[model samples]
Target chain A: MAAPASFLFKGKFLPLVLLLPQLIITGVFFFWPAFQAVYQSFLREDAFGLSSQFVGFENFTDVLSDPTWLQSFGRTIFFSTAVAGLALSVALFLAVQADKQIRASTTFKTMLIWPYAVAPAVAAVLWLFMFHPNIGLFGRMLNAAGIPWDYKLNGDQAMLLVIIASAWKQVSYNFIFFLAGLQAIPRSVLEAAAIDGAKPMRRFWTVVFPLLSPTAFFLLVVNLTYAFFDTFGVIHSITQGGPGKATETLIYRVYTDGVMNLNLGTSAAQSVILMIMVIALTMVQFRFIERKVHY
Target chain B: MLEKRSLWPYLWLGIGVLIFAFPIYITVIGSTHDISTIGRGDVPLLPGGHGVENYSAAWAGGAGRFTTTPAAVMLVNSLLMAVLIAAGKIAISLTSAYAVVFFRFPFRMLAFWLIFITLMLPVEVRIIPTFQVMVNLDMTNSMAGLVVPLIASATATLLFRQFFLTIPPEYVEAAKIDGAGPMRFFKDVVLPLSVTNIAALFVILFIYGWNQYLWPLLIVNDRSLETIVVGLTKMIGTGDAQNEWNVIMATAVMALLPPVAVVVLMQRWFIKGLVETEK
Candidate 1:
């Protein structure tokens, strides 16, 4: 029936035809590539992205047993959790404040989030330079305040620097989602709490927060996913997984193996591991966690 | 009481803003200081003459714009790709959404989950194999390389589908009764209501397109095919020659424009659609 169709159709197959292009694109670009990534992980590469040599589960076994690999994985989890938690909380607080409609709120919202537009590469430079021990802005400020701070050498401090930088960039994004969540709360509910002599904080925690669970849950998924994969630029520029791998997350290892070391097979293996973790993480969030998000 | 109670939160936001913006401001100031002075790590109220000098190196650096002006060219190329991506996305999504919600489509639930799974399997997860496919298709550095594969955006499709559901089906029914075909019904009825979603998707896709780095860097080795992001990363990321601090920052500052523009302008529209998404 759609064979001669031109401008319009009511056939059952019409929508499928419309969806065909994107679906094929997805199959070719997304699913097929994913299949290849999984397959390549079990093999070995001689040149960049070229390969042959099936060692069964050898790459997987090696990756799993390696301490550095484990360290990278552990560091990734630690990094992702810290960045997401801090960013979400700080953002939630800002969202609450802005939702109150303060006189200066619009101005603050505009400038505070301006950095979201700044490239992560630029952000890396900004942080590394700002905290540079000798002439960085934070360094000079620390001198003025009589506090000691230097990000170049100390592993713990370097980790803190990346975390803080990551957290700062993400606050604006979370703030947006949280504000939307807050604005969705019915005014009547808040008013009822107010009339019942409930304090402001109580009204928020009791009346508003439950309504915001769905958004919180949505943001948690989005933020965690972002922290896991998208931190590539930040990690590359800020630490390069150094002051001796203190900040090397899984993705860093992927890049190092693939691009730096040219060990594409091992890199593909790491990428596959990352893909599995993220998919598993996202599924858990959607299946178990998201169910608890109340309207 | 509510006003007074929320006061402390406002103060906390102030502190939050200070913490967020301080690093940027510090960088802007730091970029202008001399590299010798920069290496020395001095913070001054005014900048030294290093800003111009640094730009010279970052521009010529192994990753500099001169070495890869094509990447800057790719910025426009990416912008063109983004425009198509956003428009094509809206068109396909709207048609599909209207079909599922207004007219009954067979396998509708299957379609929804299929689309949703794309979000789960993001480009990052599939990038390795996608590269293989791209090579097979002979799309390594062509415009098709950048645009065609990405024309499929699961996020936009899902968002539009969600947004379209919120529209009153009564309008479509009314239009159908008036002898209006689905196309006419969609054009005259549905699109009028999706202004916010379209705008939001445009801004989001534009930023996503602009901010992309790894794919373009990995797949496209020809510098001319690179985007602003790849250009900036190379300009700064190179291990060659003690990096000129001022030039790298200055180049980076210039690179920041497109995403910033999208954020500033479309943020106003984004808030409205954020509610729709939540709903």
Candidate 2:
């Protein structure tokens, strides 16, 4: 909606008073820390933050040049792509199937959507339990089937585990959006396609899929953002970027370097990089994507 | 509407449901079993008789060697944090949205943008500096530290502003005609009319607050103040010997119960809030 007309209220003092609490919190919590992050990214601090010297672009250069950091950057891109692709496809498949049913659709929706309530950490733990080598059901089954599957020791297996856990937690979210988008499509169009002698698959590809592009695109950005930042807990609980740092994504690197390793400058630089990526994503979503979404 | 359908939809949906439900089902069943059964790697698909024993133990006394805080304490901490964040967010957001939509104040757009920008800077992105700020303010290990930083919500404010914009201008006119002051009008009319939106937002925000993992992990170092989500992770140590699988699974079930219950129970409102807020 357009900004409301400035029609009635007169007391500017009262309005400021009303907005005071939010402004204060935003100032202290959001803007201040953000400014500090930008500032700290340029400065190298000793272990205890007692001494600091400005190193313009050095922290950024160090982070970009470091092999582990570069590897994490590549790994994060791969992880986000995999999570987004898997989550979106599975949710779209489920949504299409669920949308076709008349009876018990809400029941299926309820069953599917409750997993959205499961926290990322809890999701990781649940999956970890299912795949724990010593005590897990599937772990034992896999070993019994002559395929050794221990995520604890194997790097590729660890990546797959975290991806599955993260994607599992995100499926419900994408399902709801896809289902809504599918339902919002007009039935008459599909009916007309059938009258034109198009088969189900042909009609879906030519008509339905094109119309769903807007929803699919919107979900692409959201899911990528989720995979980037929100899956920190998933990575944290599952592998902790373990098995020789194979599962370490960019966000986890920020946490480890900042909190555990106490490398403020490097972590702050990473934070700045992440903030830029997110802002760019947000801008792209609002500027280009929202305009293209077909209502 | 145009094509003949068979049992394929049901079959596919059934498979999907089974895939989603299986892990939770296994967790529930595992929680019911004893440590020895799980330890022996003979994971039963059925519920065991030790459900009461395992749940009670995990609830009263924590799970593993690292878990010094009981599930009860973590649950309480989570509940309190969730409720406080939800209520605090609603309160501040409503007032701020009111000011922005109703009053022509200086720096209005600036204020709105400042709050909006916070949406892009999630806690993960600014972990170090934010943590430094918390440490400087001596807010670590406190509930205020856990809740306040997370409460500056752009979504809630935007939702309220959208809702407020839809209120017919006649209502404000009528209130003015009746000599009701701004505060009175807000309290009597706006507050009453916003009940549904508030409830919807509460459902969404409660789940958000309860499900918070990283923020609590970073801010609250006190074991007693641990939220169940983080506590469950802590209970599962890196090694198998240190992890009590049965108890950990029991606590995992406990950890998910409240938020899952809220979503299921308030399914309609939660969905509406979710869809509308994102839009």
Candidate 3:
């Protein structure tokens, strides 16, 4: 960890005053809300919010026992895995190409990176426009070829559409990180491998891949977090977790239950579950960092 | 670097570029065509003559069948929200980081950890309660509601602290010898030195604030407070045949331009900010 500066200003109230805005915002917005989610998880209330009873872990039990919630949890894992896998592999491939001693590499990088600016919802719209089944170009082509290809009606198709859209939006971010990772690899190591009769592909596998593992692992955690939480916009815009809950993930279920259905107790329980998942992911990342330091 | 004369790199890169660019290409081309043309489902590769007409219709409003706010109003609201969020985050993070690094105070570690813990609690996981907090504060549908709660950034504060720690103790000693106060030293020495970090951070945060979806969607039912990202998705509605594909595509294009322009234009700083803040 980075240390504080050795020499410091001697101020009592000034430091507290300086820290107040962030503290207050964090207290009221971040901590309080998070605490509320945890608190509400244990309480069951009427739909009208008229009365509530403290049921220790009943809400958690209810959420855990619900087959739909279990399926959503399983679906979240599958969806997040697909998104992270596709995004990471595509970005790694493109980053490898960009890392080459080729012409117009900067131009290629610029083009690849601009998609990072597209909002997840906007990204969904672009993909939806392309695959909208009626007003879509590829969607029209698929139908004309006698393939049944309406995502709105088909569950698997809707799942595939969301995965593509979400991964497409993420490739740029992973590309940036992967490119930086590739560039950071020492040239001397690659040169030494080349002198030992290693071909480009072999060098990449033996020398480069291992060197980039730290980044690859880092991107994996980041991408999973993104797929879990950040893809809400993509799902919201394309399919509101529809076609009989085919595309619904844990995050989507929480929104549907809490905001749309007003099942506060169950929704709060799910939120607590997701919060634990995030904390777990973060701790895993920190542990990896610690291991890297030891190495 | 080992150099090889080959088309393999170019070929792979060309294909990658196409995959990344095709959706946007379709969006741009579709925006230029009329509703009937796009609705027919097989949009042409080239731009159509209805570009100005589609853009103007979407810009002014009433192009689509849905009851809607104008693209112009939503764009302005998004800009205001984005600016406030970026500026607010930078301001608060800078001051708080400055305090933690410069001064010795009681409960300093406690204050720092409180800020740090927020990194785990994204607005996504805590949506309902945050909305409840907003409702309780009477901040719903206001600009403050959209901006303030989101501005307390752990990453930004940590980044600033990381940067601040690198400032030489000699500089602080000299400032102290010259009888400079903490605020004065910060304004003169710290702020000027932090320009690059701030500019880079502004690029990331601006895009963040501009692209916010679920939060704005929940809190701002008011048409006047609609942000472009949420507004653009709303424009698409349920994807029925009666929708105005041309106008919707045009608004999507308009919504994308500012943040994309910022990223493309400030490519260097954006990359630096992104990599640094994540670290």
Candidate 4:
């Protein structure tokens, strides 16, 4: 959106004064730290945090070549894909049902949407309490049924646990968006499809699904970003990149390498990489929104 | 959209609602039971007599195995943090958006772009560097450290700017004709017109702030300043058999209450703000 050109107030200093607080906070907290991350990514610090030397692209190259980092990268893709796929599909189903003429639709919506208020960390804790091997009901039930299911000891189980917790919390958010998208579709289109003798499932795939693509695509970007960045608390509180780094995503690795292991240069490089990804995703989102506006 | 008499929608909704309710229902029920009942791996679907005791114990002081803090303190800290962040973000964004939309100035677009770029630098990406910045500023272990850095909101600013641009030029002309100064016009005209947007944004931002985990986890080492969201996880420590599951569940209930209440009570505004801002 462009700034208004016609009716305007004339004040040079007042406008700047008004803009100062936001600019200051953004500069100090955002731009400065981002610059520091980029700068530190190029320098290598000693073990004692004493002296540093210019390492140029060595840190990025080393992080890129590291097997553990590469594995973490792959795991992040798997984790995010699983989360987005599960959350989006489950939410779509629920939203479609809720969109129907049903009893207590608002109640159903509220019940489903309240989980959106739950913190990722809290969501993790809830799932952990339910799935802990020794005390959890489901955990004991699994063991009793001849399967071992300790997330603490098993990497794959831990991955599955975090995925469930993360996706579970995210479904509420996607549900709201999907429901909105579904409601936005005109009834005439659906009626026409039904008059053409298309079944409910067939009509959905042929008409409604295509109409909802923009919303689904938007949610895909958002869910990927959520899985990539916002699930840090889920990973940290539940798994902490545990069971030999199996649950470690890119964000978790950045934390473990930097704060836990004190590997500053590599962590900074990873941060820069994450920054680039966020910028790219954000640009895609904005461009898509611009296209939607045109339509 | 046309299936009115069919029972299929009801059936599907029943199952969906049940699935959504199960976890929270379990947590609430578990919180009511004695620790031994849950510890024995018996899932108690019914309420027990220890509900009050467990909540009281958790509220007075957390009952984790390794570390403990007062839940009351954490909840208060979370409330304050959420309010400050929401208010702080709204206040700054309103002014800045006012400046950008109403007043002509050099570098105005520069300022707007600077704020917008922060959309990319989420706290997760710049953890170490930002933490180091906090340390260098001696802002660690303080409430300002928890709230201030998070207050400069790009999405809020953009939302307000978008809304502000829609303000009729006739209003500005009328205010100018009446000799109303900028601040006077802002106080008399802009604020009133933006109440619904502000309220909607407050609901969304309050939840965003209250549910913050990593930033509070990183900067606030002091137990007193720990937010409920972060503290509740700390209460679970290692999630072992020795931990007090009842107290943790009680704390979880308490932690989720305020934001859930806000969203439910302000459902209209929350949905409006969420749908609008995301666009």
Enumerate clash totals for all models, in the order shown. Answer: 10, 0, 0, 0
| lDDT per residue as tens, model 4, B71-163 | 899999999999999999999999999998898889988999999989989999999999999999999999999999999999999999999
Ranking by TM-score: 3, 4, 2, 1
- Off-target runs (Cα >4 Å) in candidate 2 are A1-7, A289-295, B63-67, B239-242
Q: After superposition, how far is residue A291 of candidate 2 from its true place, in Å?
A: 0.8
Model 1 residue A99 lDDT score: 86
- lDDT by residue (tens digit), candidate 1, B91-113: 76666666655545678778766
Specify the highest-DockQ model's number.
3
TM-score of chain A of 1: 0.85
Which residue pairs clash in candidate 4?
none
> What value of lDDT does candidate 2 attain over all alpha carbons?
0.90
Fnat by candidate, in order: 0.50, 0.78, 0.78, 0.75
Chain B TM-score, candidates in order = 0.81, 0.96, 0.97, 0.97
Deviation (Å) of B201 in candidate 2: 1.3
RMSD of each: 4.5, 1.7, 1.4, 1.5
Which structure among the candidates has the greatest lDDT? 3
